[model samples]
Target: MRTRFAPSPTGPLHLGHAYSVLLAHDMAQAAGGTFLLRIEDIDQSRARPEWEALIYEDLRWLGLDWEAPVMRQSERLPAYRAALETLWSRGLLYPCSCTRRDIQDAVSAPQEGAEPSVGPDGLVYPGTCRPEAPPQGPMPDRAVLRLDMARALSVLDAPLRHEETGRGPGGETGQIAIPGDSLLRAAGDVVLARRDMGTSYHLSVVVDDAEQRVSHVVRGEDLFEATPIHVLLQRLLGFTSPIYHHHRLIRDAAGKRLAKRDDARAIRTYRDEGLTPADIRAKVGL
Candidate 1:
């Protein structure tokens, strides 16, 4: 019964983040399980030392404590690279040169019966790099590596299933079995390594969760649609899928998801306004 509160040190913690951390901490304490803190600073371009410090400060202010020294993703680049190499060796990864704009253009162009060409991971990759025959052409000068969903799924012994204790946007809950085709269509050829960063959220998260032996994954419901891709990656990499709890999001008055940019909702701002930990819990309906 191990749980974690993995937050990116890109901005100040908001009410939504506080809710997530509190929920995870409470669950672990109730079960007498371990609680861990992981700093997801993989996107170093946006990560800040001050932001990381603020995360610790905010969590401590919230009366949440976890085993440490905390794990930081930047320190684990070598491990992520190794995982990518392993997938590359197994022929489950291919270099993709398509950028967001290119994919948008390709998806926007009308094709007969394309079903609107949308996916959970943005516009379903148009497969611009797919070769017509074996021995695909030379890799592009600048390309990110993507998992070949079909090839990865081929090695699975059975269909993928995961336990869900929380609801999805469409009210999906309970044990869910993911069909191979549906999985691919929803998250087509998701990137494993970015051209600039060398690793991606999906690949790094799967590896980290397995390494940390997390028994339950608790996060915002907006990420529920991406769970199938995570489950698929877990199976492909021979790792266990953690029980998931996609809690409802903390939104603003207009129903907009709270973001780092929303400084008014930031925990630090509330603290500055003289709000106590108990007040925060009540405000978030914990």
Candidate 2:
């Protein structure tokens, strides 16, 4: 059994992050499985050397250790490109030049009194750049790429499903069946590549999990809605879907979810205030 705690080094490690890491690590250790750490530094624009270093420090301070030679997403660009190339060859991907404003305008253009539907990626894309026919030439170099959700589903030989070892926000559990029609209407054409990063979260995450040979995916329930997207990508890329465990999130006093911007709850701040690792565990109700 292999589990990973993947965190983006764009900000300080907060209590929310600490709870996730600790839970994942404890679960792996109890089952005698390998626990791995991954640095999701694909967003080079926001990733910082100091924050990366601080992540290491904070993890160590929490009295936990992971496998040697951690994986970094920035070094796996070639693999992501290869996966994109495969999808492109199969006519499952298309170039999208529509910006957020363009999508907003298109979504609002629907009939009056129609409230735009929101997807996991915030405001479902209206498919402005979707081609009526799949392009034949090589994939575009500079334009963002989106998966044709309808076409992708129609090509599937079998129904898509995933094992949910943990409960979803709505208390969904057991073997979850992915309804294709729901995904088509809800997710729309999701992005695979961005102009700045060359790869988006959904694309990189599935590829990374498969490459890492992760058997179980332990993450926040906030990502539970996006699991179907990952499972779809896994099937398209011919990768095995890992067992998903979407744990509860660590929220604030006002019942709001924590964010990276909340430095007051950062582990670094707590450490500076003389909190011990056990103290952290008790604080988070471990």
Candidate 3:
């Protein structure tokens, strides 16, 4: 029943973030399980000291507590690198140099009447830099690494599946079986390591969860679509899958989802307005 509230300290916490943390904390407390506060500061380019401090302040203001010596992604680079190397050794990873525009152009160009379609991870990678053979030797600097989805699936000894307590965009729930063709179309050649950041969210997240021994994953429903990819990575790396609970998102007034850029809904803004912890809990319908 171990749960975690992992937040990237790239900006101020918002109502949506408040809802997620509160839900995760409550779930852990109810089960008498461990509740961890993980700082996902992998995006070093945008991560800041002040923002990290604000995350602590906001969580305390929300009346929550977590285990000490909170885990920070930046400090776990070695672990992530090890996992990437394991996949690389298995001939699962390949270097990619394509930008967003390059992927769009390739996908846009007709190929056997297969029209370009968007996937869970946004525009399914066109595999512009995917080499016909698995790369060997040292990984290149400043080059993104992408998973070979087809090869990864084919290597699986058993069918990949995950238990979903929350519904997906298409209202899928219960135990979901991951088919080879579907995953390739939904999240083709997903990036494992970024060109600049050295590690991407998917790789870090899966590795972090396994290391933390998280038994349940409580997060926003918006991430439901990406669960299969995470499950695939977990299986590929010989890690156990955690029960997934994707709660509903806290959207804005116009039915838009809250984002880091939406300072109007930031927890700091509400605190400055003299709102109490109870008020925030009620506002988020906790």
Highest lDDT, which number?
2
Q: Which 10-residue window in model 2 sums to the lowest lDDT?
A: 108-117
Query: In lDDT terms, how accurate is model 1?
Result: 0.87
lDDT for predicted candidate 2 compared with the true structure? 0.92
Question: Alpha-carbon error at 151 in model 3, in Å?
Answer: 0.3
Which 10 consecutive positions of candidate 3 have the poorest summed lDDT? 164-173
Ranking of all predicted structures according to TM-score, beginning with the best and ending with the worst: 2, 3, 1
> Best-fitting candidate, measured by TM-score?
2
Every model's TM-score: 0.94, 0.98, 0.96
**Tens digits of lDDT, candidate 2, 71-181:** 999999889999999999999999987878988888898577888989899999988888998888988886799999989998999999999988899998899999998
Give the per-residue lDDT digits (tens) of candidate 1, residues 185-230: 7888888888877889998899999989999999999899889999
Q: Per-residue lDDT for 114 in model 2?
A: 86
* Decreasing lDDT order of the candidates: 2, 3, 1
Give per-residue lDDT, candidate 1, residue 56. Answer: 96
Candidate 2 error regions (>4 Å) = none
Model 1 residue 204 CA deviation in Å: 0.6
**What tens-digit string does per-residue lDDT give for candidate 3 at 34-128?**
89989999999999999999999999999999987899999998898899889999999998878888988888887899978687778998778
CA-only RMSD, every prediction:
2.1, 0.9, 1.4
